[model samples]
Target: MNLIDTVRIALRALLKNKMRAALTILGVVIGIAAVTTIVSIGQGASRLVQGEFQTLGTNMILVLPGNTKRGGVRQGGAPTLTSVDADLIGQQCPEVLASSAVVWTQGQVIYGNENWNPKEMLGVGPDFLTVRNWQLEAGGFFCSSDIESNAKVCVIGHTLIPKLFQTTNPIGQLIRINNVPFRVIGILEKKGANMVGDDQDNVVLMPHTTVRKRINGSPLDNVHAIMVSARSTGKMNVATKQINSLMLERHEISPGDEPDFTVQDTTEIAEALGMITGTLTLMLSAIAGISLLVGGVGIMNIMLVSVTERTREIGIRMAIGARGKDILRQFLIESVVLSCIGGVIGLVLGTGASVGATVLINMYKPGTQWPIVVSIPAAIVAIAFAAAVGVFFGYYPARRASRLDPIDALRYE
Candidate 1:
């Protein structure tokens, strides 16, 4: 028989056992659907992480306190970094554009009769918001005079707006932090959350001088961290090294002594986090791949049963002039056709499921925007995998049918 004739006959046989054929195809459908859904979710998760990082800042480098060992035990926490260190790096490092020193604190903030406690009250320089890539939603950011005068002016995040001011306009309003009054100057634009689920919009900002001398009761020179903006993404490494060297010199650490502070390149932190998420996505895809393997086995089991049931039909076809290879070709075509039908249905189902998942996540989390995308390459590969499964499983049964004894099969009633 010609290839077309063989395929037609194979299709007819499958149509004759409609219920069995549908069952056989179900396995492939389930497997392919699982794979595509997994791949889509993994890709979406990667985009979400990247977006979260870029939301709060761009090209930011952090200077943090380093740990020191006492005898065999780790004791001292990060040495206090100061505004002086930030200024030196800004002046000496050609790769740096701007820098800000942060003094971190927390206390109850009261606006009129309303009292709300914020998680962080940041003491920062005027350049901190610029370095962080944060924009104002209302009013203007404090200027250089605000820092120099040790101004008790502040910027509040969006999430804290409702809690502190309610329906009233917060701009120009006076609020008290631990009874230390501050005039509301600007409202920070909304930034949802970080990877660790911490609220990025739940803090407040003030000059480092005000925070140190007034609220925290610490010396005006004390700071917890320094945020530096690199001239460009490409210059981040150079800026970090220069900052590190300048810090060592200012702290008077000798060549063999451990540094008092640590300089962290934000670009490196972002790259490392990306790698971790990518690995997690890969592992999830692999786990979903197990379903595809199981589906292939189902095809093999059903094919074996088909070979046994069609023994007499095969014998009659041979007696009537059909070649063994033609019988093999017919059965193989039937298996492949079933897999193809299943794969098409699976592609649609998987795409819909992925979209639904994205919507649900955004709806529940609120403010967390997630992407919904179907990978065309992954769908194409899944279909190709289904075809491969058909061939590998159908071959054994096809061979078995071709080897059957004509007289024995014909006499089997």
Candidate 2:
């Protein structure tokens, strides 16, 4: 028979056993759907991490206190970052555009008869908002005059304003932090949560001098972290190296000893996190793909039974002068048809599920570009894998049917 004739006959036979064929195809569909959905989630997560880091700040460097390792052991607790290091880096690093030292105090805010139980009160220099690329929707950010004068002025983030002031205009309102009064000078633009779920919008910024002297009761020169902005993306490496050397000198670290600080660039952190998430996605997709192998084995078993049940028919075909290879080709076509049907269904279902999830995430967080892209490579892989399963599992049964004895097959019940 011609290839088309063989395929027509095979399809007719399969159509007669509709339920069995459908059941066999179900395995391939399930396996493909699972793998595709998992990979989609992985891709979404990678985008989220990158967005979160970028929102934190661009081309920025975070200098935190303490050496990364202590006594050959990695440090566990948050170490103290002093204002001296922040000053030195600002003065000595030619590639650095701006820098700030941050001191924070957790406290309650009260205005009139209203009181906020707890709020994140940040003590930062005037350049903090600028380095962070924060924009104000209502009033101006803190100025050098505010920092130098130890002004008791505050800037509140979007979420914090709603919580403390409700529908009232928070600008020019007086909110007391730890019973200390400060005028609200600015309202920061909304910055939504990051991938790890940090509330970037719930914060209050005050002058570093004010936070040090009035709230935390710490010295004016003390700081917990230093944020530095490089002159440009290309200048980050030169800036980081200069800052490290300057810190080592100021801290009096020996040539063989590690410096008493750690410097991290935001872009570098972003790339590293991307690689980690990509690897994780690949692993998860691989695990889900194992189900495809199981489905292939199931196909093999079903085809084997199909061959046995059709032994008499095979014998008749052989007796009618059909060659062994013709019988083999017919059976192989049946298996391939089954797999192809499953693959088509799976592709549709997987793409639908991925798009649905992307929609939900975007709705919850605006400006989040979680696109549900159909991966051509993944679709090709799925289809090719399904075809491969058909061949691997159908070969034995096809060979068995082809090898049947003509006279015995025709006489069999």
Candidate 3:
């Protein structure tokens, strides 16, 4: 028989037992769906992490305090790094283009009887936005004069606009941070969430001196951390080493002793996280691959059963001058069709699941935007794997059907 006629006959046979055929394809469908969903989630997570790090700009360096070992253990309470340290780093380190010292705290912000707590209330310099590559969505950044004069002026993040300002112009409007009044000078563009799950947009920025002296009862000298941007990517390491050496000298730390502060490149931290995420993606894919293998086993079991059940039909075809190879081809086609159809159904289900998952995650994580990404190559590979499974599993059964003796098959009840 021609290939088309053979396929038609094979399909008609499967149609006779629709329930059996469906049950047989169920495993394949489930396996493929799981793979596609996992791959999509992995890709989405990678993109989210990369975007978050990229926002901090290139050739960035971060310095934090209180890592000094006192009695063989680091002091743990609060950062000991101060604003003077940041200033000195900028002056001494030629590779550093700009530097910003930040003192972080949190307090309820109130406007017109409405109150909401920002995710972050940070004390920073005019260079803070420059180091972080952040831009004002409206108005302008608080100027250097604001920091120098200890002005009661602040910039608010995009998330705060809807909550506190709400359709009104926020610039020049007074908002109370812990009941301490400050004028909003600018609105920051949306930054979304970072890899640590912190909401970057839900923040308020003020001059470090103002926040230290006014909002919190702290000495004007203390700062929690410092952010520095290098002039070139190649100079990041150079800047970090110089900053480390300068900090050591400024702090009077001995060689081979733990320094009171730490200097690190932001890109290095990002690269580390990228490696971790890549490993996680690979692990997830491997788990999904296992499911695909289990589905192949199901195909083999069903094909074996089918060959036995159709023995009589096989016998009649053989008696009517059909060759062994023809019998084998017919059974193999049936298996492939069933598996391919199941794979298609799985692709639809997996894509839908990925979208739904992204939506669900975004709902729980306000200010976070996770994209739904389905890889076309991955989809093609999945489908191809499903078809290959069908062939591998159906071969033994198809060969059995082809080899049956016509007389014995006919004589059997």
Candidate 4:
């Protein structure tokens, strides 16, 4: 028989047992839907993380104090990094564009009767805003004079506005940190949240000198970390290496010995996060793929049953001069058609599910920007895999049906 005639006959046979065919397709649908949804969501999450990093500027590098070793025991991070190190890094590293020493403290911010606790209060150098690539909503950032003279001026993130100033203008207003009054010099533009959902706007920035001397009571040179910005994206690695070498030389650590500081660039951090997300996506995709195997098994089982049930019909066709190859083709086509239908339905459902999931997540976290990313290649592959599953599992049953003895099948009840 021609392929079209054979397909028509096979479809007619399935139509006679519509409920059975529908149930058989259910397994495939569930499997494909799960895989598609997982892949799409994974892609979206990866993109979101990369985008967050991009916002922070990929050319940025962070230098933090490393662990201290005493009596063969390792201690937590030591306060070895200082403002001098930050200054030297900017001056010595040719690839570095700017560097800022950062000192961190936590205190209640008060303005008149209103009092609020910020997530972080930082002492940063004059180049802090430049290194961070942050913009001002109003006023201006602290300059060299502010840091040099330890001026009591500060910049506040957007989130602190409602807590301290309400609807009143924040510029030039006095806000107290640990009862130490600081004149508001700038209002930072809103940064929303980081990739890990930390509120980026709930911060206060001051000169590193002011934070150390006035609030934390640390030495003039003391700093918690150093932030560096490379001259260009391609210079990040060179800048990181230069900083690391310069730090070791300054800290009096010998080459190949454990240094008391760590230099890490944003590119490395972004890659690490991307790797983590990619691994998770792969693991989840593998778990979801198990459903496809189960569905394949279901197809095999149902096809075997179909072969048995259609034995009489098969025998009549064989007796009427139908060939075994034609019978096999007909049965195989039926199975593929069934799986293809399920695959198409599942693709649609999975795409919708991914979008709905993103919307729900964004709704839950109002400022979040979870995205829906449906990969066309993934959809096409899912459908093709379903068709392949049909062929692989349907082969044995089709063979059995094709090989039925005409005399024996014709006499069967």
Off by over 4 Å in 2: 1-7, 67-84, 87-97, 196-198, 230-239, 265-283, 309-329, 348-376, 399-413
Q: What are the per-model numbers of colliding residue pairs?
A: 1, 0, 0, 0
Residue-level lDDT of model 2, residues 260-300, one tens digit each, is: 67898888888898999899989988888888888778788
Scored against the true structure, residue 118 in model 4 reaches a CA lDDT of 91
lDDT of 1 by residue, 282-317 (tens): 787778767766777777788888888888999999
Question: Where does candidate 3 stray beyond 4 Å?
Answer: 1-9, 52-60, 69-74, 77-80, 87-97, 105-119, 158-168, 173-183, 192-202, 213-220, 229-254, 264-294, 312-323, 364-368, 405-413
Error of 4 at 47 (Å): 3.3
lDDT value, residue 356 of candidate 3: 92
Candidate structures ordered by lDDT, highest first: 4, 3, 1, 2
Instruction: Give the alpha-carbon lDDT of every model.
Output: 0.84, 0.82, 0.86, 0.89
In candidate 1, stretches whose alpha carbon ends up further than 4 angstroms from where it belongs are: 1-7, 68-75, 195-197, 232-234, 311-327, 358-373, 401-413
- If ranked by TM-score, best first, what sequence of candidates would result? 4, 1, 2, 3
- TM-score between model 4 and native: 0.88
Clashing pairs in 2: none
Give lDDT tens digits, candidate 3, residues 109-198.
999978999988999988888788888899877777888898999999988988987899999999999989999989898877775667
What's the residue-level lDDT of 361 in candidate 2?
77
Q: What would you estimate as the lDDT of candidate 3?
A: 0.86
What's the true lDDT of residue 305 in model 1? 88
Error of 1 at 195 (Å): 4.5
Model 2: ten consecutive residues of lowest lDDT = 75-84
Best by lDDT: 4
